[model samples]
Target: MLIVTTLIACILAVLFIRLSFGVIRLRRQYRVGLGSGGVDDLERAIRAQANFAEYVPIALILMACLELNGAPLWLIAILGIAFVAGRLIHAKGINQPPPHFSNRVIGMKFTITTLIVLVVFNLAWLLLQLWK
Candidate 1:
Protein backbone atom coordinates (compact mmCIF):
# COMPACT_ATOMS: atom_id res chain seq x y z
CA MET A 1 0.00 0.00 0.00
CA LEU A 2 2.75 2.38 0.90
CA ILE A 3 4.46 1.41 -2.30
CA VAL A 4 1.34 2.25 -4.25
CA THR A 5 1.10 5.65 -2.62
CA THR A 6 4.80 6.33 -3.01
CA LEU A 7 4.73 5.38 -6.69
CA ILE A 8 1.84 7.75 -7.33
CA ALA A 9 3.61 10.45 -5.37
CA CYS A 10 6.70 10.01 -7.50
CA ILE A 11 4.67 10.19 -10.68
CA LEU A 12 2.85 13.30 -9.51
CA ALA A 13 6.13 14.86 -8.47
CA VAL A 14 7.44 14.32 -11.96
CA LEU A 15 4.35 16.02 -13.34
CA PHE A 16 4.84 18.89 -10.95
CA ILE A 17 8.42 19.30 -12.05
CA ARG A 18 7.33 19.27 -15.64
CA LEU A 19 4.84 22.03 -14.94
CA SER A 20 7.50 23.96 -13.12
CA PHE A 21 9.66 23.66 -16.19
CA GLY A 22 6.89 25.19 -18.24
CA VAL A 23 6.70 28.09 -15.85
CA ILE A 24 10.44 28.60 -15.89
CA ARG A 25 10.58 28.46 -19.66
CA LEU A 26 7.76 30.93 -20.08
CA ARG A 27 9.19 33.30 -17.51
CA ARG A 28 12.51 33.31 -19.27
CA GLN A 29 10.93 33.61 -22.69
CA TYR A 30 8.82 36.58 -21.77
CA ARG A 31 11.63 38.19 -19.77
CA VAL A 32 9.39 38.60 -16.77
CA GLY A 33 10.73 37.86 -13.32
CA LEU A 34 7.71 37.39 -11.07
CA GLY A 35 4.46 37.96 -12.90
CA SER A 36 2.94 36.97 -16.21
CA GLY A 37 3.51 40.49 -17.54
CA GLY A 38 -0.08 40.67 -18.82
CA VAL A 39 0.60 37.80 -21.13
CA ASP A 40 -2.37 35.49 -21.69
CA ASP A 41 -0.19 32.65 -22.87
CA LEU A 42 2.05 32.89 -19.88
CA GLU A 43 -0.96 33.25 -17.61
CA ARG A 44 -2.52 30.13 -19.01
CA ALA A 45 0.70 28.19 -18.56
CA ILE A 46 1.02 29.39 -15.00
CA ARG A 47 -2.60 28.51 -14.28
CA ALA A 48 -2.21 25.12 -15.84
CA GLN A 49 0.76 24.47 -13.58
CA ALA A 50 -0.86 26.07 -10.60
CA ASN A 51 -4.03 24.09 -11.13
CA PHE A 52 -2.15 20.82 -11.03
CA ALA A 53 -0.31 21.89 -7.91
CA GLU A 54 -3.62 22.79 -6.32
CA TYR A 55 -5.44 19.53 -6.92
CA VAL A 56 -2.79 16.82 -6.64
CA PRO A 57 -1.97 17.15 -2.96
CA ILE A 58 -5.52 16.63 -1.79
CA ALA A 59 -5.94 13.72 -4.16
CA LEU A 60 -2.69 12.14 -3.01
CA ILE A 61 -3.48 12.62 0.64
CA LEU A 62 -6.89 11.08 0.24
CA MET A 63 -5.33 8.19 -1.67
CA ALA A 64 -2.71 7.58 0.99
CA CYS A 65 -5.25 7.66 3.76
CA LEU A 66 -7.48 5.31 1.84
CA GLU A 67 -4.55 2.95 1.39
CA LEU A 68 -3.62 3.18 5.04
CA ASN A 69 -7.20 2.47 6.00
CA GLY A 70 -7.01 -0.75 4.02
CA ALA A 71 -8.93 0.29 0.98
CA PRO A 72 -8.85 -2.30 -1.79
CA LEU A 73 -5.69 -2.19 -3.82
CA TRP A 74 -7.50 -2.31 -7.14
CA LEU A 75 -9.68 0.65 -6.29
CA ILE A 76 -6.72 2.69 -5.17
CA ALA A 77 -4.79 1.87 -8.30
CA ILE A 78 -7.69 2.66 -10.61
CA LEU A 79 -8.34 5.99 -8.99
CA GLY A 80 -4.67 6.82 -8.86
CA ILE A 81 -4.20 6.08 -12.53
CA ALA A 82 -7.31 8.00 -13.47
CA PHE A 83 -6.25 11.01 -11.46
CA VAL A 84 -2.82 11.14 -13.04
CA ALA A 85 -4.25 10.66 -16.48
CA GLY A 86 -6.64 13.51 -15.84
CA ARG A 87 -3.89 15.82 -14.77
CA LEU A 88 -1.75 14.95 -17.75
CA ILE A 89 -4.64 15.49 -20.08
CA HIS A 90 -5.42 18.81 -18.44
CA ALA A 91 -1.85 20.06 -18.56
CA LYS A 92 -1.55 19.23 -22.22
CA GLY A 93 -4.86 20.81 -23.05
CA ILE A 94 -4.26 23.99 -21.15
CA ASN A 95 -0.70 24.40 -22.32
CA GLN A 96 -1.57 24.06 -25.97
CA PRO A 97 -1.03 27.24 -28.00
CA PRO A 98 -4.74 27.75 -28.38
CA PRO A 99 -7.71 26.37 -26.53
CA HIS A 100 -7.82 22.60 -26.67
CA PHE A 101 -11.52 21.98 -26.42
CA SER A 102 -12.17 18.27 -26.12
CA ASN A 103 -9.20 17.23 -24.04
CA ARG A 104 -9.76 20.14 -21.70
CA VAL A 105 -13.33 19.08 -21.06
CA ILE A 106 -12.41 15.43 -20.83
CA GLY A 107 -9.53 16.21 -18.53
CA MET A 108 -11.73 18.03 -16.11
CA LYS A 109 -14.35 15.37 -16.46
CA PHE A 110 -11.85 12.71 -15.46
CA THR A 111 -10.65 14.79 -12.56
CA ILE A 112 -14.12 15.50 -11.22
CA THR A 113 -15.17 11.90 -11.63
CA THR A 114 -12.11 10.64 -9.81
CA LEU A 115 -12.62 13.05 -6.96
CA ILE A 116 -16.24 12.06 -6.54
CA VAL A 117 -15.35 8.39 -6.56
CA LEU A 118 -12.55 8.71 -4.05
CA VAL A 119 -14.56 10.86 -1.70
CA VAL A 120 -17.58 8.59 -1.82
CA PHE A 121 -15.51 5.48 -1.33
CA ASN A 122 -13.56 6.90 1.57
CA LEU A 123 -16.60 8.24 3.32
CA ALA A 124 -18.50 5.01 2.90
CA TRP A 125 -15.57 2.98 4.11
CA LEU A 126 -15.16 5.12 7.19
CA LEU A 127 -18.85 4.94 7.97
CA LEU A 128 -18.80 1.20 7.56
CA GLN A 129 -16.07 1.01 10.14
CA LEU A 130 -18.05 3.19 12.47
CA TRP A 131 -21.13 1.09 11.88
CA LYS A 132 -19.16 -2.03 12.66
Candidate 2:
Protein backbone atom coordinates (compact mmCIF):
# COMPACT_ATOMS: atom_id res chain seq x y z
CA MET A 1 0.00 0.00 0.00
CA LEU A 2 2.82 2.37 0.78
CA ILE A 3 5.21 1.47 -2.00
CA VAL A 4 5.28 4.86 -3.62
CA THR A 5 4.87 6.57 -0.30
CA THR A 6 7.83 4.69 1.07
CA LEU A 7 10.00 5.84 -1.80
CA ILE A 8 9.10 9.44 -1.18
CA ALA A 9 9.46 8.97 2.55
CA CYS A 10 13.07 7.93 2.18
CA ILE A 11 13.96 11.06 0.31
CA LEU A 12 12.14 13.14 2.92
CA ALA A 13 13.89 11.32 5.71
CA VAL A 14 17.25 12.29 4.32
CA LEU A 15 16.22 15.91 4.32
CA PHE A 16 14.83 15.61 7.84
CA ILE A 17 18.04 14.11 9.13
CA ARG A 18 20.06 16.89 7.55
CA LEU A 19 17.93 19.46 9.29
CA SER A 20 18.26 17.59 12.56
CA PHE A 21 22.03 17.61 12.22
CA GLY A 22 22.06 21.34 11.67
CA VAL A 23 20.05 21.83 14.84
CA ILE A 24 22.27 19.50 16.82
CA ARG A 25 25.45 21.16 15.61
CA LEU A 26 24.15 24.57 16.54
CA ARG A 27 22.94 23.34 19.92
CA ARG A 28 26.33 21.94 20.84
CA GLN A 29 28.06 25.08 19.65
CA TYR A 30 25.82 27.21 21.80
CA ARG A 31 25.93 24.71 24.65
CA VAL A 32 22.19 24.89 25.19
CA GLY A 33 20.46 21.64 26.12
CA LEU A 34 16.96 23.02 25.87
CA GLY A 35 15.38 25.93 24.06
CA SER A 36 17.43 28.51 22.08
CA GLY A 37 19.33 29.87 25.08
CA GLY A 38 18.73 33.40 23.77
CA VAL A 39 21.22 32.88 20.96
CA ASP A 40 19.80 34.15 17.67
CA ASP A 41 21.66 31.71 15.41
CA LEU A 42 20.70 28.82 17.62
CA GLU A 43 17.17 30.16 17.72
CA ARG A 44 17.08 30.30 13.93
CA ALA A 45 18.35 26.74 13.69
CA ILE A 46 15.74 25.58 16.12
CA ARG A 47 13.06 27.45 14.22
CA ALA A 48 14.13 25.91 10.95
CA GLN A 49 14.00 22.48 12.52
CA ALA A 50 10.69 23.20 14.19
CA ASN A 51 9.20 24.60 11.02
CA PHE A 52 10.17 21.52 9.05
CA ALA A 53 8.78 19.30 11.77
CA GLU A 54 5.52 21.19 11.70
CA TYR A 55 4.90 21.05 7.97
CA VAL A 56 6.59 18.07 6.32
CA PRO A 57 4.75 15.36 8.28
CA ILE A 58 1.33 16.58 7.25
CA ALA A 59 2.34 16.79 3.60
CA LEU A 60 3.85 13.34 3.68
CA ILE A 61 0.81 11.84 5.34
CA LEU A 62 -1.45 13.38 2.75
CA MET A 63 0.76 12.10 -0.03
CA ALA A 64 0.90 8.61 1.43
CA CYS A 65 -2.87 8.44 1.84
CA LEU A 66 -3.43 9.73 -1.65
CA GLU A 67 -1.09 7.15 -3.11
CA LEU A 68 -2.81 4.40 -1.12
CA ASN A 69 -6.13 5.63 -2.46
CA GLY A 70 -4.84 5.24 -6.01
CA ALA A 71 -3.60 8.65 -7.02
CA PRO A 72 -1.44 8.81 -10.12
CA LEU A 73 2.25 8.02 -9.80
CA TRP A 74 3.32 11.19 -11.58
CA LEU A 75 1.20 13.29 -9.25
CA ILE A 76 2.77 11.77 -6.19
CA ALA A 77 6.28 12.21 -7.48
CA ILE A 78 5.72 15.80 -8.49
CA LEU A 79 4.23 16.68 -5.15
CA GLY A 80 6.94 14.89 -3.24
CA ILE A 81 9.69 16.66 -5.14
CA ALA A 82 8.08 20.03 -4.73
CA PHE A 83 7.53 19.49 -1.03
CA VAL A 84 11.13 18.49 -0.48
CA ALA A 85 12.43 21.38 -2.51
CA GLY A 86 10.27 23.70 -0.44
CA ARG A 87 11.69 22.47 2.82
CA LEU A 88 15.23 22.53 1.57
CA ILE A 89 14.93 26.02 0.25
CA HIS A 90 13.16 27.15 3.37
CA ALA A 91 15.78 25.65 5.62
CA LYS A 92 18.63 27.02 3.60
CA GLY A 93 17.08 30.44 3.67
CA ILE A 94 16.20 30.53 7.34
CA ASN A 95 19.38 28.79 8.45
CA GLN A 96 21.39 31.86 7.58
CA PRO A 97 22.84 33.91 10.37
CA PRO A 98 20.52 36.84 9.71
CA PRO A 99 17.82 34.98 7.76
CA HIS A 100 17.42 35.52 4.04
CA PHE A 101 13.97 36.74 3.12
CA SER A 102 14.02 35.87 -0.57
CA ASN A 103 14.77 32.23 -0.09
CA ARG A 104 12.45 31.93 2.87
CA VAL A 105 9.65 33.59 0.94
CA ILE A 106 10.17 31.38 -2.10
CA GLY A 107 10.44 28.30 0.07
CA MET A 108 7.20 29.10 1.86
CA LYS A 109 5.58 29.78 -1.48
CA PHE A 110 6.48 26.29 -2.62
CA THR A 111 5.29 24.76 0.65
CA ILE A 112 1.93 26.49 0.56
CA THR A 113 1.47 25.67 -3.09
CA THR A 114 2.19 22.03 -2.41
CA LEU A 115 -0.19 21.93 0.52
CA ILE A 116 -3.01 23.57 -1.39
CA VAL A 117 -2.58 21.26 -4.32
CA LEU A 118 -2.48 18.21 -2.09
CA VAL A 119 -5.55 19.23 -0.14
CA VAL A 120 -7.58 20.00 -3.23
CA PHE A 121 -6.42 17.00 -5.19
CA ASN A 122 -7.01 14.56 -2.33
CA LEU A 123 -10.38 15.99 -1.41
CA ALA A 124 -11.53 15.90 -5.00
CA TRP A 125 -10.40 12.36 -5.43
CA LEU A 126 -12.13 11.31 -2.24
CA LEU A 127 -15.33 13.00 -3.26
CA LEU A 128 -15.23 11.38 -6.66
CA GLN A 129 -14.70 8.02 -5.08
CA LEU A 130 -17.64 8.58 -2.80
CA TRP A 131 -19.78 9.64 -5.74
CA LYS A 132 -19.09 6.35 -7.40
Candidate 3:
Protein backbone atom coordinates (compact mmCIF):
# COMPACT_ATOMS: atom_id res chain seq x y z
CA MET A 1 0.00 0.00 0.00
CA LEU A 2 1.11 3.53 -0.78
CA ILE A 3 0.19 4.93 2.59
CA VAL A 4 2.72 7.74 2.61
CA THR A 5 2.04 8.63 -0.99
CA THR A 6 -1.69 8.51 -0.41
CA LEU A 7 -1.53 10.86 2.52
CA ILE A 8 0.77 13.22 0.66
CA ALA A 9 -1.51 13.11 -2.36
CA CYS A 10 -4.54 13.93 -0.26
CA ILE A 11 -2.78 16.93 1.22
CA LEU A 12 -1.74 18.04 -2.22
CA ALA A 13 -5.26 17.57 -3.51
CA VAL A 14 -6.62 19.86 -0.85
CA LEU A 15 -3.98 22.45 -1.64
CA PHE A 16 -4.79 22.13 -5.32
CA ILE A 17 -8.43 22.67 -4.57
CA ARG A 18 -7.59 25.73 -2.54
CA LEU A 19 -5.53 27.09 -5.38
CA SER A 20 -8.36 26.36 -7.80
CA PHE A 21 -10.75 28.25 -5.59
CA GLY A 22 -8.36 31.14 -5.51
CA VAL A 23 -8.42 31.24 -9.29
CA ILE A 24 -12.19 30.97 -9.35
CA ARG A 25 -12.55 33.82 -6.91
CA LEU A 26 -10.20 35.95 -8.91
CA ARG A 27 -12.00 35.18 -12.14
CA ARG A 28 -15.31 36.12 -10.60
CA GLN A 29 -13.86 39.29 -9.22
CA TYR A 30 -12.32 40.24 -12.54
CA ARG A 31 -15.43 39.10 -14.45
CA VAL A 32 -13.51 37.19 -17.09
CA GLY A 33 -14.52 33.84 -18.52
CA LEU A 34 -11.38 32.79 -20.32
CA GLY A 35 -7.74 33.47 -19.60
CA SER A 36 -6.72 35.99 -16.99
CA GLY A 37 -8.62 38.86 -18.61
CA GLY A 38 -5.51 41.01 -18.44
CA VAL A 39 -5.61 40.99 -14.67
CA ASP A 40 -2.23 40.40 -13.00
CA ASP A 41 -3.61 38.82 -9.85
CA LEU A 42 -5.78 36.52 -11.91
CA GLU A 43 -2.83 35.63 -14.07
CA ARG A 44 -0.74 34.81 -11.03
CA ALA A 45 -3.53 32.77 -9.53
CA ILE A 46 -3.99 30.87 -12.75
CA ARG A 47 -0.30 30.16 -12.99
CA ALA A 48 -0.11 29.10 -9.37
CA GLN A 49 -2.82 26.50 -9.90
CA ALA A 50 -1.43 25.43 -13.25
CA ASN A 51 2.04 25.16 -11.85
CA PHE A 52 0.82 22.93 -9.05
CA ALA A 53 -0.98 20.75 -11.56
CA GLU A 54 2.14 20.52 -13.65
CA TYR A 55 4.57 19.39 -10.95
CA VAL A 56 2.56 17.24 -8.53
CA PRO A 57 1.55 14.21 -10.58
CA ILE A 58 5.04 13.06 -11.46
CA ALA A 59 6.21 13.64 -7.92
CA LEU A 60 3.44 11.48 -6.57
CA ILE A 61 4.15 8.77 -9.12
CA LEU A 62 7.81 8.63 -8.21
CA MET A 63 6.97 8.63 -4.54
CA ALA A 64 4.53 5.76 -5.00
CA CYS A 65 7.10 3.78 -6.94
CA LEU A 66 9.63 4.33 -4.21
CA GLU A 67 7.19 3.16 -1.58
CA LEU A 68 6.21 0.07 -3.60
CA ASN A 69 9.83 -0.79 -4.14
CA GLY A 70 10.26 -0.94 -0.38
CA ALA A 71 11.92 2.34 0.25
CA PRO A 72 12.13 3.31 3.90
CA LEU A 73 9.00 4.89 5.28
CA TRP A 74 10.96 7.58 7.03
CA LEU A 75 12.63 8.58 3.79
CA ILE A 76 9.30 8.58 2.01
CA ALA A 77 7.78 10.70 4.71
CA ILE A 78 10.62 13.21 4.58
CA LEU A 79 10.46 13.55 0.81
CA GLY A 80 6.71 13.82 0.88
CA ILE A 81 6.82 16.50 3.52
CA ALA A 82 9.48 18.42 1.64
CA PHE A 83 7.52 18.29 -1.60
CA VAL A 84 4.35 19.46 0.09
CA ALA A 85 6.17 22.25 1.85
CA GLY A 86 7.69 23.29 -1.45
CA ARG A 87 4.33 23.48 -3.18
CA LEU A 88 2.74 25.45 -0.39
CA ILE A 89 5.63 27.86 -0.22
CA HIS A 90 5.70 28.23 -3.98
CA ALA A 91 1.99 28.89 -4.15
CA LYS A 92 2.17 31.45 -1.38
CA GLY A 93 5.11 33.15 -3.01
CA ILE A 94 3.53 33.23 -6.44
CA ASN A 95 0.23 34.51 -5.09
CA GLN A 96 1.89 37.48 -3.52
CA PRO A 97 2.69 40.78 -5.18
CA PRO A 98 6.12 42.06 -6.18
CA PRO A 99 9.39 40.98 -4.50
CA HIS A 100 8.33 37.38 -3.99
CA PHE A 101 11.53 35.97 -5.42
CA SER A 102 13.04 34.50 -2.28
CA ASN A 103 10.15 32.25 -1.39
CA ARG A 104 9.78 31.18 -4.99
CA VAL A 105 13.47 30.43 -5.23
CA ILE A 106 13.58 28.55 -1.95
CA GLY A 107 10.43 26.64 -2.85
CA MET A 108 11.77 25.54 -6.21
CA LYS A 109 15.00 24.49 -4.59
CA PHE A 110 13.11 22.25 -2.20
CA THR A 111 10.88 20.88 -4.97
CA ILE A 112 13.70 20.19 -7.38
CA THR A 113 15.83 18.71 -4.66
CA THR A 114 13.08 16.31 -3.66
CA LEU A 115 12.55 15.31 -7.27
CA ILE A 116 16.24 14.69 -7.80
CA VAL A 117 16.47 12.60 -4.69
CA LEU A 118 13.43 10.54 -5.65
CA VAL A 119 14.73 9.96 -9.14
CA VAL A 120 18.09 8.86 -7.84
CA PHE A 121 16.49 6.58 -5.28
CA ASN A 122 14.19 4.99 -7.84
CA LEU A 123 16.96 4.45 -10.32
CA ALA A 124 19.19 2.99 -7.69
CA TRP A 125 16.44 0.67 -6.56
CA LEU A 126 15.79 -0.45 -10.10
CA LEU A 127 19.45 -1.11 -10.67
CA LEU A 128 19.65 -3.07 -7.44
CA GLN A 129 16.64 -5.18 -8.38
CA LEU A 130 18.00 -5.80 -11.84
CA TRP A 131 21.31 -6.92 -10.45
CA LYS A 132 19.69 -9.23 -7.95
What's the number of clashes in each of the models?
A: 0, 0, 0
Compared with the true structure, all predictions reach lDDT values of: 0.89, 0.89, 0.94
Model 3 alpha-carbon miss at residue 104, Å: 0.7
Model 2 Cα shift for residue 41 (angstroms): 1.4
- Winner by TM-score: 3
lDDT order, best first, reads: 3, 2, 1
Q: Model 2: per-residue lDDT, tens digit, 1-90?
A: 777678878887888888889889988988999999999988888888899889988998899879988889889889988988998999
Pairs that collide, model 3: none
User: After superposing candidate 1, which stretches have Cα over 4 Å from the reference?
Assistant: none
lDDT digits (tens) for residues 8-73 of candidate 3 = 999999999999999999988889999998999999999999989999999999999999998899
- lDDT minimum window of 10 residues, candidate 3: 98-107
Model 2 residue 123 CA deviation (Å) reads: 1.0
**TM-score list, all predictions:** 0.94, 0.93, 0.96
Against the hidden true structure, what lDDT does model 2 obtain? Answer: 0.89
* Residue 9, model 1: Cα distance from true site in angstroms: 1.1
Q: List CA RMSD, all candidates.
A: 1.2, 1.2, 0.9
lDDT-better candidate, 2 vs 3: 3
